[model samples]
Target: MSTVLIVQFIALAVSVLSFGVALWLYTWVKSQPSKNSRVETIAELIRRGANTFLRREYVVLAKFAGVAAILILLFIPHPIWTGGALDNILMAVAYLVGTAFSALAGKVGIQVATIANKKTAVAAQQGIKPAFLAGFRGGAVMGMAVVGSSLLGVTLLFMLTQDATTLLGFSFGASSLALFAKAGGGIFTKTADISADLTGKVELGIPEDDPRNPAVIADNVGDNVGDVAGMGADLFDSNVASMAAALVMAMSLDNGTPGKNVLTVFLYAALGLLASILGVGTAKMGRGGSPTRALNSSTYVTTAVYAAITALATWQLNLEWRIWGAAVIGLLVGTIIGLATDYFTDDTKPPVRHVAKASQSGPAFTILSGVSYGFLSVLPAMVGIAVASFASYLITAPLGAGYAMFGIAMSAVGMLSIVGMIISNDAYGPIVDNGRGLVEMCDLGDTALEITDSLDSAGNTVKAVTKGFAIAAAGLTVIALLGAFIAEVNEAIVTRGLNIELLTGFDIMQPDVFFGLLVGAAIPAVFSAMLILGVDRNAQRMVTEIHRQFKEIPGLKEGKAGVTPEYDKCIDIATTGSLKELLPAGALAIISTLVVGFVGGVHAIGGFLTGNIVSGLLLALFMSNSGGLWDNSKKYVESGHNGGRGSDAHKSAVVGDTVGDPFKDTAGPSINTQITVVSLISSLMASLFLTFSLF
Candidate 1:
């Protein structure tokens, strides 16, 4: 066998090992003690609500996926009458495989997270060590499942078809699922979150996660659905797109000698997963140790391990040092972006304190300060992405034609190489967030509540950083996919014997290109608006329901025994409302891309993607950071920094946080998937656009 095949097998083996470790972790979490009946009852309610939402969401998604599959069969890559029927079928199947794997990964996350919340809550009664372990390991299961499945799916598809275009099909499938999963999950989470806060804290003056609140259980369920499952699907989409984009560029390079580049991408990704597994295995906190420190330490360790292993591989395999340099640049920039995000969102930082101080005046000041800092926060991440792309291109330009673009693709792979660990950390946030709520509901004592609160606080801090990292990786991935689009369009032109010259690049001076650019820039804004509006409408409905229950259900607000508020009703409303609102936003994104491609040809589409990425990144960064700032500010005020809980400053901070809930959780992160979907749509339809576009 060739060296490439050997390396490919090794990557596959590593993927299998990741699954094994995830299983072990899952079982270990399950084995943890959970003897309290009240804890078990609350946990079961959360589990049931989460599963019901997922089942309903998947049912809706199935219909959407089926329609997409048929459309792919009919028109993608080529029409059926062009004698490409077999290829179309294979592509459709690949797409289905992608969606199935992504959905499965999310299911696994939800399952383990629900179990871990109870375990962590129970363990906290003992101490921080066992509680921290339960939350971290539970999250690791999700991380391993997501990265492992993405790797295994990519490798298996390539091995079967040996076609980069088919891999694009699989990626589109993942993007499709992510579009709905992220949007729907985001809306569900924020809707529940906002309603819970509005009714419980603002109106009733009750503490968070209070059993008197109808929406509290729904809020906990939302943590799993939105953060754990939704985030897992989002990263899965990004990871698959990165590999698909890289393979497409690599296959078009070195006079068709794509083996070396393919092997290099696979090897780098596999090593990253291995590094994450080791990092997860070693993650631990001593008695009274900081959860934030433990989480950050594990991330640093993973980065170091990935760098060491990939450097050794580059040296031994005689790969281009320039490509390796590009990858390193990406990895370094990703870390820098994370640190920058942490500065803006961390409560210990000045940004959070500043926001908290501003809250003393009013909610308006809180919003103003947070928004200003949020805009400032966008600069570093945007610059980092630009630097990584430009530096990678320059470094590899001397090698040969097309290598520069391939280098950019490699940078994306390198940046996302440790996505396994990123997902683990991201998932860790929601698991512990749920644990904190469970502690309150179970009445596990003030000490246990405090311990879980600390863990949850760390989870929130780390979540902000990981969101920045994930968004940056997606930005870089889509930049690489733009190159793949050019390659795909050119190949279609050549195969069809078209008279048009190959597109070297989009010229900014062209009218069609500029038009597409303006339109594309508006898309992320419009998409975000639609989602936020959905949350607004949904939250209003749920809030009304909460009020009705409080007024109608006697003894509920008086803390009378045997009179629980209607939790399931709020969960149902969130589920149904999210499903309803998510479809239109996702449809708008896909439809607009198709409209642009068909309107001005591929040139217009190129400009469209460029605008989408720029505006999307800006909005995503602004909203995510500002939202995190508001949240941490509220936490800071509650910590007695500004007037303590129930003070005027705390009330103002709550208002700011409520407004930010949908901004950060619902619309911001979903933009990452939206851009990826448009990019894949452009690539998948390149052939049709080449032949059929009017302009």
Candidate 2:
């Protein structure tokens, strides 16, 4: 075993152990009897009532899960598990089957739990069974179905892309970029939803730290454990697995010998898994009361990994200065992007009376700081891409280094906070609105719910979604330009022995072709927006139906009928907030499509758009759903803490006082893997497509 492999194994084992310990402590705490930490005064009671709730199961389950994961790690055998075209095909098939089964199983379990919770809660309230209790089961089942279908779709996509590139003469470069672009769009959409849920809905109705707030408990568990830990596992399992598989394939092609650098793949896999855990853990630990702590840890972990990997790759691969150069360039690019965002971002603070104070150079300094930070963020990603692409060139057989570079470049862009923020916003949207609706229902003594400050989260989600679209636009544009250049070179090389007339009509910018590419670019956003609208509408309808049914209950007859204006407004804000954003997003997409198509050709643009959409959607769905799960779990805990009974006055008073669950859901889930996946998947697809297209 290589030294690197040994180190990786050790790290993975430690991660598992640490996760186990954390879970054990959490469960231990929960198993104990509830302690009444005194409410010192009336204010204290009000505060304590809201802030004390936390799901005790997270720690317990996490520990067991962690330990289990470690044990599972041992099963990953030595030697390259996947090599050659046949091996990749089989690996893709396995991933597809595994993800499908997992999704189905998870969905069923969730539904059963939801059903049980609703049924038991209602049965205690009334002598008769509650209809909504059954609704929980249906919803859970439906959720799982959605997840399964989505995963199946993605897995199939990966299969097709790989097959097309290797077996069929499809360009790896084209397919990969298209997937990433699509995934980017989806990630942005889902992230925006999450943000809306946290800031607008959750913050307005219930604070993250409020133990009495069911929303609080839900956010804690749903966003923290589900999003952070679950995502950690999922991302590591899927993306890292795919990457490792791809790396093995690429290296085999380059080396012309299957055995060369076999240990590197294993080592990287271990590192990737560990990194995944830390990436998620940092975010989870930051929520409720420790935002900065979680964020800082995440930053540190990512930085350390990036630095270590770059150093090792450079030394082992004998890539000379390219490694450091790539890292530096990445950092610089990231910083520039950050600076631009900071500068362009309009000051959201209310108009101040002191114009001089407002005009202070603080904005400029902030821009500079953001730029510098952006550079830091960009370096790791850039270096990763650089190493992967450049290393391909040194091998006797080329594995399409150019396409690898393209993917890496896109991945680097994903590291930026702008991408992270956009993702966070989408994931939080639904949760926030749900909280607001719940609070409003309680306050008005009506079936109708009212909510204020509920649109903030929605707006944030929209903002993030828009920003992500813009980023995708930019990424697609770059890929297209690069692809066009590659095509030109390929045409020259391939045409040497053939009659030039056979390839003479190869116009890169066919109008009909370009049009299709443009359409594809816009498709992901449209699909995501429609999905969000559909899901939210369904949720609203269900909640409304539940409210109506509650009115039929004898004791619940105190509430009035119909939806309130506030609730209506909240819905409008959440649904339509991104509409205007769509216009700009569309424009950017169009511009990117045109630029790339014009420069490279219709095929390149199409590939770029396709890859982006696929990757974006996958990332978005992962973050949004996972975060929602976390939010729900946290709510369950808070519900139990609030004397296992609903309390409105207490939930409302402290709801406005708490900062949202930004750390666990947004900074953690939305920011890290969701964003990273967009780039990673795209790059892998691009490289694979390049090889296929060449043949």
Highest TM-score among the candidates is held by which one? Answer: 1
Q: Encode model 2's per-residue lDDT on 1-695: one tens digit a residue.
A: 75534543454464354345334423332232212222112113222221221112223223433442332222211112333444444433433343333333223322222222222222222211121212112222222222222223323343344321221111121222222222222322233334333343343443333222212222222322232223323322232223333333333333433232333333333343334334433333311222223323443454456446645765775543432443333433433432332222212211111111211233333223323332333333333333433432233123344434323332322232122222222222332232233233233222212111212222232332333333332333233223333333343335345342322122426654455445544544443444344334433443343344334444322323532222222223322332222233323333454344445443454455444444443333333322322223223223343222223322321221121222222322232222222233323333233223422
Quote the positional error of residue 372 for candidate 1 in Å.
0.8
Which ranges of candidate 2 are over 4 A from the true structure? 1-92, 97-238, 241-249, 252-269, 272-290, 316-508, 557-695
- The lDDT values for all models are 0.93, 0.31
* TM-score for each candidate, following the candidate numbering: 0.99, 0.43
Residue 455, model 1: lDDT of 93
What total of clashing residue pairs does each candidate reach? 0, 104
Give lDDT tens digits, candidate 1, residues 78-118: 99887968999999999999999889978999999999999
Off by over 4 Å in 1: none
Native RMSD of candidate 2 (Å): 15.0
Candidate 1, residue 147: the lDDT equals 97
